[model samples]
Target: MKLQNSYLADFLSLLFPQLCPACGNDLVAHEKIICTDCLYNLPQTNFHLHADNIVARQFWGKINLETAYALYYFTKGGKVQNLMHHFKYNGMQQIGNLLGNIAGSQLNKNEKFAGVDYIIPVPLHKSRLKERGYNQSACFAHGLAEKLPAVVEENNLVRTKATQTQTHRSRFARFENMQEVFVVNNPERLKDKHVLLVDDIVTTGSTLEACAIPLLNIPGLKLSIATIAYAE
Candidate 1:
C-alpha cells in the first residue's frame, strides 16, 4: 500500500499530470522524480570508473584533486534539471537524497574514490539555509553517507559569508565572489583526512573550487568531489 503522500502525488498527477521531466512521459509510481524510460535513457557520464575523466580534467593545474565524478550528464530541460529545481526551489529534499543513494551505490565500488575518511557537503549560507530549511547538498550527502564507508561531518566545512546566487554570475565572477564566502570552522577535524565533497550539481566548477581552496591548505588533507549531475 502506498503512503498518503504517495497516493496524493498519484492523484495530483491526474490534475497536474506528472510528466517525466526528461521525456514528457507519465511517471510510474516507483519512478518518483523521473520515469523509468528516462532513467535508462539519461546520458550517464560514467566518470567514476575512470581517473582521467573530464570532471577530473577540469580541476587539473587549478586544484590538486585525487578524484572527481559526476553521476549524470546534465541536459537542458532534462529530468536532472527538474530534480535540481525541486531540490533548490520546491522543498523536495527527499528526492535529492534518493538520487544521492543511487549515485553513491555506483561510486562506492569505484577504485579511485577509495579510502575516503569523511563526507563533507558544501555548506549553504545561513540566509539560504533558513529559507530552504535545509541544504539540498546535505540531503545528498546524507544519502551518500548511508552507502559509503566513511563517516559524515556536517559542520567541519561551512559557508561563513552570505553571497549572491551563482547562477547569474559568470564563472570568473562566481569564483572571485566566493573567496571568503566559505571558511573552515573546525580545521582540527579535517587534518590528515581524505574527504569526499558532495554537492547537488557541478556547473563551471567555480563553487566547488572555492570550497576546495580553504580545505587544501589544511595539512595532509586530500580531496575528491562528487555531484548529482555535471553541466557541460
Candidate 2:
C-alpha cells in the first residue's frame, strides 16, 4: 500500500508539478513551498543576533522595542520578493508557515527573544481581512509559536480603521495615515507580558510604529518586533 501510494503521488506530481515560488524550480519530495537551494540562498538578515540592527534602529526614538528582526532582506525583483508575491497575493499561505518556522528556529537560539509570552500579528481591519481571507502575519506567528514558548494571540491588537495603501507614501505621511488606526481590545491580557509583534514586511516602519504605540502603553509590557522580510 505504501509503495502504491508513493507511485500514485509521483504520477500526480508529473502532471501537476509543485514549483518553488522563489526559483520556479520543481520542489523535491521533502521540500515544501520553496526549494532547498532557494531557501539556503535567501538573503537572511540575521538581525536577531544583533541589538542595533536596521529594523530595530528604525524604532529607536519613535517607539520602544526590546529587539527587532526579520527573516530575509527584500530587494526589488528578487527571489524573496517573488516568494512574497506568491505568499500575499497567490493564496500560498503555507509559505508564511515555512518562513516563520525557519525564523523561529533562529530566534529560539537568541537570548533577546527568550521568554516571549505572547506572539501577536499586526491585525488587519475586518474589510481587508474579509478580502484577503487570512492575515498573512498570523500564519507566520502560528508557525513561530510552534518552535517557541509563546502563545499566538490573535484579535487582541486590532486594526480599528482601514487606511489607504502605504505603497508610495512618504515616511511621515505613512505614519500620519496609520495614526489612531489600531487599538488593544484586551489590554489586561498583554499587561506585564513580553509581547512579540509580527508583520509580513517592514518598509517605512510606520505601520509597525503605530501598532507598537498602543501595545507599549500596556502596563509593564515589554515589546519586540519580528517580520518575514525587511525592505529598504
Candidate 3:
C-alpha cells in the first residue's frame, strides 16, 4: 500500500509539478517549499556552536545576551536572500517553518540553547501584522518550538508602535528609531526563565536590541536570540 501511494504521488507530481520557492525550478516529490539543492547550499553561520561568534559579539557592549545564533548567511542576490524574499514578501510563510525546523534541529544538538524555557518572536506592529496576515518571526518561532522542547509565546512581548523599514538605515539610525518600541507584558511569568527570542532575519541587530530591552526587565531572565538568517 505504501509503495502504491508513493507511485501515485510521483505520478501526480509529474502531471503537476510544484515550483521550488528559492530557485523557481520543478520540485520533486520530496521537496516542499525549497529544493534539496538550495537547502544544502544555504550558507550557514553555525553560531550556536561557538560562544564568541560574531552574532554574540554584536551585543557585547550594547546588550547582555546569553548567546545568539543565525542559521544562514544572507547576501545580496544570493540564494539565501532569494529564499528570504519569498518567505517574507511572497507569502511563502511555510518556508519559514521549514527552515526553522531545520535550524532548530541543529540548535537542539548544541548545548548552549538547551536551557531555553520559552520562545519569543520579535513582535510586529498590529498594523503590519494585519497587512501581512501573519508575523513572520512568530511563524519561525512556532516552527522552532516544534523541534525544540521550549514553548512558543507570542503575546508576552508587544510592539507598541509601527516604525519605518530599517532596510536603508544605518546601524545608529536603526537603533535610535527602534528604541523603546517594545514592551513586555505579564513580567511575572517570565522571571528567572531562559528565553529564546526569535526573528526572521538580523541585519543591524537594532530590532533585536529593542525587543530585548523590555525582556531584560524581567528578574532573573536569561536571554538568547535566534534568527533564520544573518545579513553580513
Please write out the lDDT profile of model 1 over residues 58-144, one tens digit for every residue.
889999999999988887887768667867787777777877788888888987565888989999988888888999888988888
Off by over 4 Å in 2: none
Shift in Å, residue 10, candidate 1: 8.0
Per-model TM values vs. the true structure: 0.88, 0.98, 0.94
Top TM-score hit: 2
Q: Residue-wise lDDT of candidate 3 within 116-189, one digit each (tens)?
A: 99999999999999998999998899889999999999998999999999978999999999988999988999
Q: Candidate 1: how many backbone clashes?
A: 0
Model 3, which residues run further than 4 Å from truth? Answer: 1-15
Model 2 C-alpha RMSD vs. true structure (Å) is: 0.9
RMSD of candidates 1 onward, in order:
3.1, 0.9, 1.6
- TM-score of the candidate numbered 3? 0.94
Each model's backbone clash number: 0, 0, 0
Model 3 is weakest, by summed lDDT over 10 consecutive residues, at: 21-30
lDDT of 2 by residue, 1-232 (tens): 9999989988888999999999899987878788989988999998988898999999888888889999999999999999999999999999999888999999999987977999999999999989999999999999999889999999899998989999999999999999999999899999899999999999999999999999989999999999999999
